[model samples]
Target chain A: MSDAAAQVGLPPVTPEEDHKVSEGKGRAFLGIPVVGWMLIFFGVPYFLLFLQSLWEPTAFGVAHNWTLENYKLVFLGDTLSGNIYIPTLLRSLKVGAMVTICATLLAFPIAYLLAFKISNSRTRLMLYVLVIVPLWASYLLRAYAWKVILGQNGLLGSVLDQLGLENTFLNNLLYSQTAVVITMTHIFTPFMILTIYAVLERLPPSLIEASKDLGVGRMKTFLTLVVPLSLPGVIAGATFTMGLSSGDFVAPQLVGGKNDVMIANQVYSQFGATNNWPLGSAIAFVLLGFVAILVALSTQAEKREQL
Target chain B: MINAESGLTGAPTAGAPAGHAAAVELDNVTKRYGDVMAVEDLDLRVEDGQFLTLLGPSGCGKTTTLRLIGGFEAPNRGEIRIAGDDMSSRPAYKRPVNTVFQQYALFPHLSVSQNVGYGLRHAGVSRSDTAQRVAAMMELMQIPDVGERRPRELSGGQQQRVALARALVMEPKVLLLDEPLGALDYKLRKEMQFELKRIHREVGVTFIYVTHDQEEAMTMSDRIVVMSNGHIEQDASPAEIFDRPLTAFVADFIGDTNIVHGTVTRIDNGHATVDVGPLGEIGGSTDDDLKSGDRVRVSIRPTDVRVEAGAAGEAVVQDSVLVGGHIAMKIASGDETVVAHVARGSSYEPGANVHLHVDSDRIRVFAAAEGA
Candidate 1:
């Protein structure tokens, strides 16, 4: 054969045909199991929940009735008993926003330090391990730990008492919105750090040097070059933090007061003490929808930034 | 003309103006990385509008020297001056110099035009002026149409041009290029070398280029500073370096040459007669004073050695490599092998005995102890 054909090594074939054949068989082999797994674990439950949300809460359990009362009770009720959904969701969203902002602000410098400032690989790995060590502990245990730290007679309260500020600490230190926000920020900050660090680590050092050589100062370089490039990770981190913290039931339950209850706590009460699966499913779907919208918006923003 | 204090001093060339402040000067600059010295006490003066190249092998401190001038690095013991201003403590951004980094380092996020206009924007140039200058630089680089494309979308050569445009558009007092064309393929590298030279001439900015490729340095640099082991081995014009390398390291580094070791038998005026064991006695010019029994090395270019049909001093033809336009024949003279470039059509078979003649005037002798 000719040199061209020899270099190509095989007879010419249409790529689309080859792709179709490989995808038809190979996709079924690999993709079918994953698809089946997702459907079994995620799809079936989610569909059931959606169906349940359309029914009504009965004396014993839920009844098979097509009604919008659950949603109406969720969105339109006036009092806390009539409609705790709006207040709880609004509080959850506020907490999520605060957690996201605080976590991102706290994580950025830490990620920058790990990725760029600390050049020694062992030291960087140690620091990264330090961030991940807290994650290895049980999530519920961590939430409870936050409860002990922020409790009436716990570490913070005793410290405040020693400092002669017992009155201020006794009134609002434990079972407050600040306690929940603080705990949520602390727990979720590592995820943001890891994500942003991953992106920043891949950035070539020469780009920063080039920016400096071009007469841009350190702050400008960070703003114009480093931050823009690390944005996808930032958005991903925000989405993850927002998604996790807003839907979290434990942190709010352990450290939060009645005024600071999140939507997840309401969902839990509906499923447990209230015996209202349909209303619980509706609240869960609302939280899921909100998180989904947030994730979609963030991913879209990240895509636009890339372009 | 060359001195220990001044390193290697060549007479001011046409491109270098008389009695002007050196575009970039390094005085007693020493950069140490922990225990190892990256650049030892070195003195260098790059004249305005002159393309001075730091040409060396890996770990030879060429890139380190470029980084020093660009203010990416500060000397541990000495001073760096740019355009008569002492820049010893100034960071890279504060210094009035820019660098075309190795592998381009073009901003992947920015378009070609934005990347090129980066410095202009930082310099407080208005949008209209930034655009005009960016367009002008792109046109000069012959990449006017690639302004809208991202750096990753461009080919290597195009990326290189964009890098050049970026650095040059800044209108800095000096441009530090750190192996800027090192990433391009051979053909594109050759093309970029000419482009760089043309741009240097057109812009007349002091360009300090770093490269390990000797041919690239010779082709593009007005002057080449050959470095080895964190010190300058030789600094001179490309022709002067090629013709009369100050040390054996420079002779070997610049091109293929026969480094014949010999001991001086006599010194007549400025020339010395040295006994090269296998090649017999050869007369060559020396820069250092030589005694009757001083050891020296003599460098002979391959093209200067003549191989004739008649056998006077017997040499066995070991190999004949048919390079285009000429044949590089390696002949064994006694125990030592001497390479000669003969006309391509010459029919000399391996194992044939051929007579070798050295062009006495073209031989350069250096003190044997000065060899790297």
Candidate 2:
């Protein structure tokens, strides 16, 4: 075998080559579950939804004849409903924007403190658990927990009444767009925090030290070095927050007023009560497309900018 | 001679011309991180326009001392004076020194020009001046064309050049290099050693280098401060360090040596003869007091161990390998293995009787209970 290999000009098989051959098998084995899951669960359903969006709705179910009316109606507006869909979508986007901005503003300082200020590994671990422990609780429970805290007759009203300041704490703080934005922000800020924290933690301390060593002070270092380097994490977290909050229907259903009905709420009504799967799927695809465009834009911005 | 070739005659940025106070001075600096004393009551005076290296093994406080000098870490007790200014309480940005970090730490987001000009921008240099300085520095580092390229896009050697350019552009009072060539391959590191030396002489900036590699220190530094266990073991020139090491640790750590335990049998004039067991007596000169019966440790370099073919010998040749310009041979003497280097033409087969001659003038003797 050795003589044949030498004649063929094949390099002698070394330990490193032997190890790489075994590693290839392990890699393929490790990749199986994700591939299988994405194919079976995500790919099939997403394909069906896309197909349903193109199909025409009939008396029985979706008809074989394809139509663009469902998509056209979404953009052009429904004449009978008096422009409900577009306004609801704009409102959902507004709510998402407000929530994302609020969450980002709230999360950056916390993540910075978590990554830099806290040095003890045990303490950092404890703080990390504290941030993540709230996530393990049911999302519905957390959304409703905001209601218990912010409701007009719930925690705020009682606290105001106890403090003897009735008129000072008045803002129609429940069953409104404000309430919906607040609830969504509360629900989604943790993802932003964790993302930014991970990015900040992986940043080499030497980078910051180098910045300081080069005659840049603390504030300037934060602006130039810290902020720009962590911009990728900001974009990722913002994308996550925007996509999830804009497409979410739970908060609008739970604590939102009638006027707080968003695109997802319209999507739910189309699918559930009306049984209009084609329109529902179209609306769903539209939201997905908008968020996908946003994600693409943010990713492009991230690629174009480097710190 | 090397500086003339680099084309950088006037380093106007090198603050406080050479005849000022020492470039950097540490007055009894002590730093303790919890239980471990990183540095202890260290008083070091780095003269102006000198390439001084803090040479030691890992965890020897070399890096800690550099950090203290650079204001990255404030010493717990003592003053750090840079250009005769007490900068003990000042932050890193306020100091007159800059550091070329161990890993380069070039800003990845910025172009090479931007990274090199970053300090000048903070120093409030005009935009055009910053550009000119950055360009001049890039040219000096031989990386003029890489200005528009990001640090990640450049090769490791180029990145190192960019780091040097960035740190040197501002012409800091003193430059702290924390093993700047450590990340490079052996060949690149050797090339960089000479390059760094040339640039050092050209720029005329006081350089405080930190490295565990003793040979690199010997090659580049005008003064090498040998450190061990958070304290200075020997602060002297490289030649002095190699020839007359102050302690057992300094002798062993600087280079390969055959350290044998022995006792002082005679002290004649300036020389002390040690009674090494089995291998017999070896004579060496010591700077410290040496009694006739005092226990000592002797260090003998491989080059000092002369070899001769003999029928009756105390050592047997175990192996001989041709290593570049010399033949490195291992000889078994009693229970100990002693290495000896001979001429490239010298040949000795395994199990051959070979006599060893250690030069008394080259042997270094130290107290037995010294730094371990």
Candidate 3:
């Protein structure tokens, strides 16, 4: 046999066929599990949600009628015009953006401390436990605690009343967007800290020392080396905070007023009070789409940062 | 010309020869971590453009000494000076020195060119100048193609070269290399030793290298400062250190040495006749100050002792080993065993009572009390 034929274990003229066989098997090995899981969970649920959004609500439970009316009703602002759906959606996006920024900013210093400042393993572990312990508590309980703290007759009001500043505090602080943001930030801050901490921990200490040895100051080292290297964590934390805050219905419901209602609360309202299941499903899908877009953008940003 | 300063107290003048300027001076430098003293009373000087290696085993404060010089840690006492200027209060960034760490410590996230350009960028050099300097450094290190590759993407040797380039591009007066070739394999490390020596010469910067490997220290350094227990045991050229170690620690550390304990029986001229327990009276040069009855350890390098067939003289061969480049034989006189090395093709068998002759000039005598 010729060298080419022997090398490929095929006749010279049939190389393309051999290549196809190997490529097909290789792709099949990689694609089967991912495609199977996606079809079973994500693909099926999304398909059902699409069907639900198209179905019209009738006197007998819900009925299937392929129409754009439900989507039109959501967009037109004529159905429950004065209600909180559109405003809540906008508020949720704003809250998500705010939480993302806050979490990222707060996480950087804590992560830097854990990764570089604390050298002893036991001390680092203890600090890590302290940061993570809040996460073990019930999310609802934490949100409820925030409500108590911000309520008119609660912690803030009591403190302000003692200081003779109760009037100003009550008017601005309780049941507001600010209150919702503060609560969400508390709940999600650990997630951001832990994610960023993990990435920072893997960073080689030598790089920082090398930076210093090269006559780069501490602040410059953080800007040039620490921040750029730990960006994946920042992106991950941002995506997580955005996803959680935008989809969160409970925290805002407890601490937020009618004006503070987010898109999740709107979806809940559409499903429960209005009994508009199709509109609710459409709104939920829209939120999912929005999150998917954000996730994609963040992933693209991460890749660009890597380059 | 040598600085004509009178005593040790006199400051080494500024216009002293390039090799006598004391580019780096550590006077009574000490470092303590809690109760443990990592470095104790380290007094060292690196003349301008000298390649000085801090040689020691692990945890011997060689790395700590490098850190002190780099201004990474403050000494508990004394002071550090770079070119006669005190730098005790200066942080690592402000010091005019850079270290190439053992692991190369190349920034994994950055391309080679970016890492090399980092110091220049921090120095506020123009972007174009930084790029030009980085390219020049890459060319100097002979790794121009590796500039675009991330550290992990390159081989061990490639990463090493990039690290050297990165530190050298800064044009620091002193370059501290903390076991820089420790991560490379034997052959590669040997190659890098030569490359580093060449680079040090070409750059004309004082290179303070740290390594536990004695062979590497011997090959690359203009002078080797042998350290043990955070104290300088002996500081000399590799040849002097190997051929004339002042302490048993330096004798044992530098290379293979057969140390036989003996007591001086007689003193004549510069030669001392020693009576080793099993070995009969042997005469070796007394390079140290010793009394007639002073106990001493006689250090003989394997290469200096000669083995012969049958009893040509008064030595008895106990065992013979044929290592590739040379034949190593263990010879004994009574109860004392001495290791001897012969040329590769020598046919010598164990149990043959052979004569052992040593080059008297190559043997070193040290006080047994100083053995570590």
Best DockQ among the predictions, by candidate number: 1
- Candidate 1 local accuracy as lDDT? 0.87
lDDT tens readout by residue for model 1, A14-68? 6676677877755656677899999999999999999999998899987798998
Candidate 1, residue B178: how far the Cα is off, in Å: 0.6
**Native contacts retained by candidate 2:** 0.91
Q: Candidate 1 or 3, higher lDDT?
A: 1
Tens-place lDDT per residue, model 2, A1-307, is 5566779998767767678778785667678899999989999999999899999998768896889989988888766876667777888998999999999999999899999999898998998888888889998998898788778778887888898886444457778888899899888888999999989999999999999999999999999999999988898899999989998899988889888999999999988899999989999999888888998999898888752
Residue A59's lDDT within candidate 1 is 92
For model 3, residues B5-114, the per-residue Cα lDDT tens digits are: 21222233223344444678888888998998889988887777778889999989999999888877889998888987899778999988989998988876788899
Score chain A of each prediction against the true chain A by TM-score and list the results.
0.87, 0.87, 0.82
Give the DockQ-based CAPRI class for model 2. medium
Going through the candidates in order, what is chain B's TM-score? 0.93, 0.93, 0.90
Top TM-score: which candidate number?
A: 2
Tell me the lDDT of model 2 at A283. 90
Candidate 3: stretches off by over 4 Å: A1-51, A65-88, A120-122, A165-169, A304-307, B1-21, B311-322, B330-337, B349-355
Candidates 1 and 3 compared by TM-score, better number: 1
TM-score per model over all chains: 0.88, 0.91, 0.86
Candidate 1: clashing residue pairs, number: 0
